[model samples]
Target: MPRSALISALLLASLSLSLNARAETDPWANYDKVLKTLPKDAAATLDRGVSCNHFSGEINGDNSAADKQTFREMKKLKCGTVDQDIASVKNKYKNNKAVVNAIQVYYEN
Candidate 1:
C-alpha cells in the first residue's frame, strides 16, 4: 500500500477500536451517573424499580433455586410502588428531557 493509504487505514482501524471499546462499556455506569443527579429518594426509588423489573423478568415456572430466591428478593423491592414513582418522576422532571428519557430507557431495558 502507498504510505498515505496505510496511514488512512491505520487511522480508520484506531477509530473502529475506539468505537468498539465504547460500545462494550457498562451501560449502568451512565445510568448511575444520571441517577446520581436526582434527589436521594428519587434515585433510590428508580434503582429499586429497575432492579425489581430485572429480577422479575428472570422468573418463570421452571425456576431454579436461585430464580426463586431472586423472586423473593424482588418481592421485597415492593414493585407496586414503581408505577407511582415513575409517574411522579416523570412529572417532576417534565421540564428536563434528558432526565425523563434516561429514566424511560432504564425502565425499557
Candidate 2:
C-alpha cells in the first residue's frame, strides 16, 4: 500500500480498537453521561428507578466492569430490586427521549 493509505489504515485500526475497548470496558458510559445531565432530583429518581434495566442488560451478557459498578451504585441507592425498578425506568425512558437515548446508546454498546 502507498504510505498515505498505510497511515489511514493504521488510524482506522486504532480507532476501531479504541471503540471496541471502550465497548468492552463500559457499555453504559455514554448513557451515564446522558444521565448525568439531568437535574439532581430527576437523575436520582431515574437512576434509582431504572438502573436495574441496565443491570438486566449485564445479566444478559455484555458484562462490562463499568456496567457492574453502575449496578452496585444503583443497589447502594436503595432502589427496589432490579425487577421492580426496570419497568419504572422503562417508562421514564419512554417519556424522556434524550436521557433514554443516552441510556439506549449505553445499552446498545
Candidate 3:
C-alpha cells in the first residue's frame, strides 16, 4: 500500500477503536452524580432497580418508550443511555424488587 493509504487506514482504525470504547461504556454509569437531582422516591426506585431482575429484563428491550425518553433525559443530565446503564444494574440486582423500583424511578423522575 502507498504511504498515504497506510496513514489513512491507521487513522480509521484509531478512530474506530476510540468510538467502540466509548460505546462500550455505560451511559448511566454516572448516576451517582445525578442522584442528588432525583427525588427521594426516584432515587430509591433507582436503587431498587439496581437490585431487581424483572424490571431489568424489560429495560433491556426497546419497547419501553418512557424508559427510552428517560434515557434521553439522562444523557442531558449526564447520566448516559438507560440500556447501557441497566446492564450491570440488572446483574447487580437481578431478581430483586429493586429492578422494578429503579425502572419506576427512571420513568417517574
Candidate 4:
C-alpha cells in the first residue's frame, strides 16, 4: 500500500479502537446501544427506568441532609414507575435470554 493509504488505515483503526474502548468503559452508553436493537416500546420503557435510577453521588462525597432530601424527592418523582417498567420489559423480552440478561445487568433497580 501507498504511504498515505497506510496512514489513513492506521487512523481509522485507531478511531475504531477508541470508540470500542469508550463503549466498554461506559456501561450506560453500552446499554443504550443494546436497547436500540429491541422494539421501540420496550426500549423506551426500559430506558426510562434506567435513567430514573441512575445518578452519581455529590461531588464533595458528603451525604448531607440536603442530599438525602433531594434524593428522596427525586426517587418519588422518577422511581414511581420503575417497577412497572421493569415488569413490562421483563414480560416483553422474557423469551430472549440476551435481552433479559441485559435488563438484569444494567436496568434493574
**In candidate 3, which residue ranges exceed 4 Å CA deviation?**
28-109
lDDT-better candidate, 3 vs 4: 4
lDDT tens digits, residue span 1-109, model 1: 9999999999999999998888667566588788888777667877888888888778876878988898789778877678788778778878977667767778755
Question: How much does candidate 3 score in TM-score?
Answer: 0.31
What is candidate 4's TM-score against the reference?
Answer: 0.52
Single out the weakest 10-residue window by summed lDDT for candidate 3.
49-58
Model 3 clash tally?
11
TM-score of every model? Answer: 0.68, 0.36, 0.31, 0.52
Model 3 gets an lDDT of 0.56
Question: Clashing residue pairs in candidate 4, if any?
Answer: none
**Model 2 TM-score (2 dp):** 0.36
Please give the lDDT score for candidate 4: 0.73
Clashes of each: 0, 0, 11, 0
Comparison by lDDT, 2 against 4, better one: 4
| Residue 88 lDDT (model 2) | 55
lDDT of 1 at 87: 79
Candidate number that wins on lDDT, 1 or 2: 1
- The alpha-carbon deviation from the true structure for residue 2 of candidate 1, after best TM-score superposition, in angstroms, is 11
lDDT of 2 by residue, 13-107 (tens): 99999999988777455556766786554466555555545555555345678767766765786645533444456565677776565444543
